[model samples]
Target: MQDMKIADLPVHDRAIDITGETCPMTFVRTRLALDSLPDGAVLLVRLKGADPRANVPRAAADQGHDLLDMFDLDDGSAILVIRKAGA
Candidate 1:
């Protein structure tokens, strides 16, 4: 997989929408997807609720990939853009 350029990142990828899910489940699914990807792959995660938004990054940070960016959509939902680090 290719590392998405910063500008093109927000435009693409098959997103995982984990809305209506809480805390660990959100992180769990994200981790599972990330774990299976090769370095440079990107995962776009849409999560609801504050804890998942806040806590997921902390958990992801520990995994070595930088949480490249996050944006809150107008509908009170958030999108997290994560990129795998180091080949």
Candidate 2:
């Protein structure tokens, strides 16, 4: 991705709202979507519960994307914004 801080990321180009989606499937779908984005593209992921919150970011990071930000929303779900890396 570009040489920018997580907060410096521009508006998200895409969003994967997996609020009601279950475990492994959560990250699975996330990975699939991320793979489809172009370099430096930003994605906002809306998810619920602890498992997805804990695992998806780590997994995405491990896959070489940047976990720009992650925080809880008022409805008990959370939003994780990541900027895609590489070609």
Candidate 3:
């Protein structure tokens, strides 16, 4: 795949790696991770497959978080950079 990640982005406040996790767990972990952050805090979430690539971002947006970027890495996984919406 083409390298489309943004070169300069906001520094993430935290990171969660859910590569081996599945649907509900993927989202659950993401939600919990976001909850730990204060407003405007950025999080870097590492996940894999089409499901996570699809669901996580949508769920984050629905919950009012900012989905800053989604990048597909050479490892066949992806990175979702999200900023917590409120304190």
TM-scores across all candidates? 0.80, 0.85, 0.87
Tens digit per residue, CA lDDT, model 1, 5-67: 447547544468888778789999988888777788878888878798788888998978888
Candidate 3: which pairs clash?
none
List residue ranges in candidate 1 displaced over 4 A.
Answer: 1-13
lDDT winner between 2 and 3, please give it.
3
Model 2, residue 10: what's the lDDT?
Answer: 46
For residues 1-87, write the lDDT of model 2, one tens digit per residue.
234344753488888889889999999989888888899888989899889999999999998999988876667887799988884
Each candidate: RMSD:
6.0, 6.6, 3.3
lDDT of each: 0.79, 0.85, 0.88
Per-residue CA lDDT of model 3 for 1-87, tens digit only, reads 455454443477888899999998999999999998889999999899889899999999999998998877778988899989984
- Pick the lDDT winner: 3
Cα deviation at 54, candidate 2, in Å, is: 0.3
